[model samples]
Target: MSQPPLLLTVGEIARRLDTKVHRIEYVIRSRRIEATGWAGHARVFSEANFDHIASELIRMDADRHPSTRSNG
Candidate 1:
């Protein structure tokens, strides 16, 4: 429900998601999330990319935690 950043690094995304950076990288490598492009030596993600990843992770969390699931 909040606005996403214009761009972010994997570490920033991981911190925002309360996960580890390695997990973020894993998500990228596994194609769960897509990078927008490169920023210096780091990977960049657009607002759309972050939104997509956040939604996917939420869905994954719902799958892992039944209490978080919706009736619909």
Candidate 2:
């Protein structure tokens, strides 16, 4: 069986998403997205969950900016 991907830290994810660490915590608390462990101490994200969160954010941004929509 294939091994699971490693978890991601809050700071790492925030840096990648170009957002504040607090925003990450807010998402976790609100359950807008699921994550593993706590923040600063043991916070981490699965590859699938991270991708899911990223996709959701992208979709939200697209919805906010109709001009960015593609013809296809």
Candidate 3:
């Protein structure tokens, strides 16, 4: 109970992020995010993976829109 989730399923990630399942898979497949390992038969993603994905997205957005960069 203290260890957090071992891994979140694709659907669970989508639910948490309020995005589509395909989007989640795309990030995982493209290596923008990572799946920790397999469990039984499912590809398992760490809770930290969402944080990683969020960071990557922010990086990408800043790269695409330089004007969004903070002046401070």
Over 1-72, each residue of candidate 1 has an lDDT whose tens digit, in order, gives 997558999888988989878766766777657678898999899877777777777776777899867788
Ten-residue region with minimum lDDT total, candidate 3: 52-61
Q: What CA RMSD would candidate 3 show?
A: 2.8
Off by over 4 Å in 3: 1-5, 58-72
Across 1-72, the per-residue lDDT of candidate 3 in tens digits comes to 486676877888788778788867777777755578887887778868877765656676688999989999
Quote model 3's TM-score.
0.62
Best candidate, lDDT: 1
User: Any idea how many clashes model 3 has?
Assistant: 0
Residue 18 CA error for candidate 2 (Å)? 3.2
lDDT of candidate model 2 versus the reference: 0.74
Lowest-sum lDDT 10-residue window in model 1: 23-32
lDDT of each: 0.79, 0.74, 0.75
Over all chains combined, what TM-score does candidate 1 have?
0.73
Q: Which residues of candidate 2, in runs, are more than 4 Å off?
A: 1-4, 26-31, 38-40
Candidate rank order under TM-score: 1, 2, 3
